[model samples]
Target: MNFLSPLTEGLRGLGRAVLFLFTILAGIPAALLRPRLILQQIYSVGVLSLIIIVISGSFIGMVLALQGYRTLVNFGAASSLGVLVALSIVRELGPVVTALLFAGRAGSALAAEIGLMKATDQLSGMEMMAVDPIKRVIAPRFIAGLVAMPLLVSIFSLMAIGVAGGHAIGVELLGVDDGSYWSQINQAMHGTDIRDMLIKGTVFGLAISWIAVYQGYHAAPTSEGVSRATTSTVVVSSLAVLALDFVLTAFMFH
Candidate 1:
């Protein structure tokens, strides 16, 4: 009976999460009608996340270019480095890394903010005023995350492209042929890669937002509980991002 209790609780929680998701989705149209709310959250979650994404993308791109250059040079295929780097960024690293970062930054922030709101009885105050907190608060944040993710992934990939990404190190520093670099990328990269990136970004955004908001919404109205929910948001959102990336990669690439 004791063992079954945990399983039952997990199942019950899953059910609640699904229901909560539906409620948010139902409110999204209304939230969209109030684009200002969504825009505010976009600034909160998306714009604020750019510094980390840019810095991380730069480092990742530089490292990948350096390592790939060494290995490809051994094979006398150094010219293909640009194609390798671009494909890697567009297909895998861009969306996945951005999502992990988003989970850590925006996702945890969303959970903590909402949890604090709940703890402070702000949500209850809305109810007392006959307002739907779900419509006013959660849905806008969810929509903002959903809209901002693909944009963030695009920015991150751009960072990996020329600014501080592979091009800076692969071409200028490593003496790779400039024409071969861009031309190879033009030839090898395809529309499917872009499609895959956008799809993964959108899906990951939805999943991360759902987990963050749900955890916060249900958090016990206490300081410790809000803190736990915030921690859980980061942990669960990260695991979910990795798992979903694997699934998405297998489905899209394989």
Candidate 2:
């Protein structure tokens, strides 16, 4: 029992830390009203994330098509491959997987950069110079992340669909008709599914960027601390995306 006490205590502390971060992020709206920060945030989250999203999305679609076609063919349901590929990529796998990759690539970078700024007191200096750090730093990041994620996800979804289409035409060996494939894709996609994916992407973006900034802001004032904060931001953001996915799925689908 004594040995278990330390583990329990550590868990409690971690929970409290996470809770505190949520409270701070929830309060970010107060800082988001500044115009300068909003533009910067838009650039950081939206513009920067585009390349990675496009590249990853294209490949994911191709891979999904390749794998999904194999499975469907085994069951002699190869004609429905487009429907399954589109739905899985657009509604579920696309947003979640892209977000996870984004978190690993960009989320950690954001955290480390911000953590370094915090450690070096650069953030404090901004405050001293009549800059609201939240407005200047956190607000843009939050807004950028929120705005960029959906756009990136949307781009990813489109590219993935394209790639899947190409793969089906070339590699699936399914002999599926082109018109049939597109018809199935169109039938399977609904306005609601699009809305759901966009919502999920937006929320994921906000959560990931917020986690990175929050971790950076609260990191220990040392280089080692910044490294740890960066790593933690990626891990926590990825887990949060999965957790939120389940919650959103229950609400949207169930």
Candidate 3:
């Protein structure tokens, strides 16, 4: 019975989380009626995250280019460096890495802010004032996440910082043939690659936002509980991102 208790609790938690997610989803229409809330959350979570995203994307791209150039040069295929970096960043790294970073930065912040609100009885205060916190609070953040992720992935992989960093490293620094670099990238990249990135971004955004909000909403209303929820938000969101990336890749690429 004791061993079964853990499994039972796990299943119960899963059910509650799913219900919480659905409630937020259900509130989205009403939440949308107030576009200012969604816009505010977007600026909070998305705009504030741009610095880290751009800097990290640049560094990740540069590292990919450096390592890829070495391997391709060994194979006398240095011209393929651009394709390798592009595919790697666009197909995998951009979405997954960005999600992880988002989980750490924005997701944890969401959890903490919400958890603290709960701890301080602010959510209760809202309920007393006849305001539904789900529509007023959670849904806006959830929609903002959904809206921001695909755009961030595009900036990271497609036309801006990440690919540009790779180009700088591969072509200018390594002196790889510039024509072949751009030409191979243009030739090898397909619509499917872009589709995969967008899909992954959107799915990851949903999962991360769901977990963050759920954890916070259910956290015990205490300082320690709020801290635990914040930590759980980051840990659980990261693991979920990695696992979902694998599943999405298998399904999408297969």
Instruction: Output the worst ten-in-a-row residue range by lDDT, candidate 3.
Output: 155-164
Q: Give the best candidate by lDDT.
A: 1
lDDT of 1 by residue, 1-254 (tens): 79899999989989999999999999998898999999999999999999999999898889989999999999999999999999999999999999999999999999999999999999999999999999999999999999999999998998887688899999999999989989999999999889899999999999999999999999999999999999999998989999999999899867
In candidate 2, what are the lDDT values of residues 59-105, reduced to their tens digit?
Answer: 77777777887888899877677787789888988799878978887
Could you estimate the TM-score for every candidate?
0.98, 0.85, 0.96
Kindly indicate the candidate among 1 and 3 with the higher lDDT: 1
- Expressed as tens digits, the lDDT of each residue in 93-182 for candidate 3 is 999988998999889999999999998999999999999999999999999988988877877775332345888898889998889988
Local error of candidate 2 at 36, Å? 4.6
Candidate 2's TM-score reads 0.85
Backbone clashes in model 1, listed as residue pairs: none
lDDT computed for candidate 1: 0.94
lDDT of each: 0.94, 0.79, 0.89
Model 1 CA deviation exceeding 4 Å by range: none
RMSD of each: 1.0, 3.0, 1.3
